[model samples]
Target: MDAEQQYHTVLAIAGFDGSGGAGIPADIKTISALGCYATSVLTALPVQNTLGVQALHAIPPEVVVKQLDALLTDIPPQAIKMGMVHTKAIVSALTKRLEAHTKVSLVLDPVMVSSSGHQLMEKSAIQAMITKLFPLTHILTPNLDEASLLAKMPIKTIDDMLQAGQKIKDLGCQSVLLKGGHLKGNTLTTIYFASDGQQHTYSFPKIETPNAHGTGCTLSSAIAAYLARGENELSAITKAQHYVYQALLQGKDVAIGKGKGPLNHFFDPEKTIKRKAESGKQGN
Candidate 1:
């Protein structure tokens, strides 16, 4: 193997959704579509579909740690994306392993609830995630509901989103991306707040569609892929937002399930990116 030629790899630690609409499946699709090699560690197995999650079976904390150890030791990822940690034990396990690799950018999608209003995380895990995982996260991507839970307030407008984003950022993450898709309006606005006193606002017309399942997973994975390819946080997030927007627009009418369908993750896939292993830089 030539050190000069390597794949830009991203690791996704998340739950397994057999529906292929969310969780590990969505992460793999999104990362691969964005031109990165995706590796995953299944944290939980959720009996779910486009409709909603029925039940969840969590992987043991020790098993999860072993998986992390195997991957982090050999195919070390350039970036990591985490979603749907269901328990405090899993959070503690992940935190212990992640402490050694602080250099790797981590994009965390705090998935607390499913699109169909099913709780995906335990209430106790919320506090653990905030105390243990937030400081290690490079960027925290939380939708309106999750943000409301984290900030302990409702987000009904862009102003509320800004306030909520700031509040979440104060909890220790380097930055927060508060998604406003749930707000009642024709337009959706997402705000990004950084600890450095920088903020970015992204607003676009909402594409009315039921095929929006796994959007949060896709968006966060895309951000990790971009980061693996060496983009800055803001650039990676901006590109990822555009990718999700296009995916939603393209898959608006395509139906895959009885309930909400999934976005076409491979609508326009890119070739796997190559980079130099020794230099830790992207290569054409």
Candidate 2:
């Protein structure tokens, strides 16, 4: 193997969305876009589109376990990302597999609900996730909707975002990035709270568009890919946000479906490569 080859990897444990807007395919695209090798273990199959999810079928836990076992037996990932685990069985299976391989960072995208008023995760699965998976997560990224659900309060203001960030951090997550895209504002304020007793608030002028369906999946997966490439936690989160912001900005006018569409995760790969080189130079 060439020692200089940048082959960082992120393994995504997520569902399959045929629409390509979110889930396993989105994870693959985001990780690959950020210069990381993408791998996956599908947890569910959701019949979804830009409009809404029509149906969902969770994959059997044993099959999910077998896939993880096979993957972990061969190669290891630098980071692992969790998305759309809709069952307690899946929660338990993933937790067991992840606990066995403890070296990688885990980015948990708590996808309990969708933008279309669909309950993606079962109520029974919530406890399993909190008890088993939350402790394993290195970074938890939840949108304003999901954060409100986890924090057990309505999150509508910037102060609400900060309070919710603290509440989520107490739930065994080492760090939390409370996403503010769902909030009402011209500028989105992403709140990043770490275990280091410091907070980082990043603001981006909101892009007005309906083509932001898979932003959560893209953001978390991008962060995982950046972390896999040896970026610090906070830096990875910030860079991933920038990448997604750009992707959404460029994808706003794209008409992929009749409703809210996805981000252009592969919008500018050449530019990303150039930026990576520039950052590498700066680091040296």
What's the number of clashes in each of the models?
Answer: 0, 0
Q: What value does the lDDT take at residue 169 in candidate 1?
A: 95
Output the worst ten-in-a-row residue range by lDDT, candidate 1: 275-284
Q: How does each model score on lDDT? A: 0.92, 0.87
Clashing pairs in 2: none
TM-scores of all models?
0.97, 0.93
RMSD of each: 2.2, 4.7
Q: Model 1 scores what on Cα lDDT?
A: 0.92
Cα lDDT of model 1 by residue, 224-275, tens digit:
9999998999999999999999999999999898998999999999998777
Candidate 2 lDDT over residue span 1-284, tens digit each: 32233456689989888889899999999988887778899999989998989998878999999998877765467799889999998898788878877678999999998889899998889988988999998999999888888899999899989898999899898999989988887998998998796999999999998999889999999999889878999899989999999999999999999988999989876322322232232211
Candidate 1: deviation at residue 105, Å? 0.3
- lDDT score for candidate 2 against the true structure: 0.87
As a whole number from 0 to 100, the lDDT of residue 197 in candidate 2 is: 65
lDDT of 1 at 86: 88
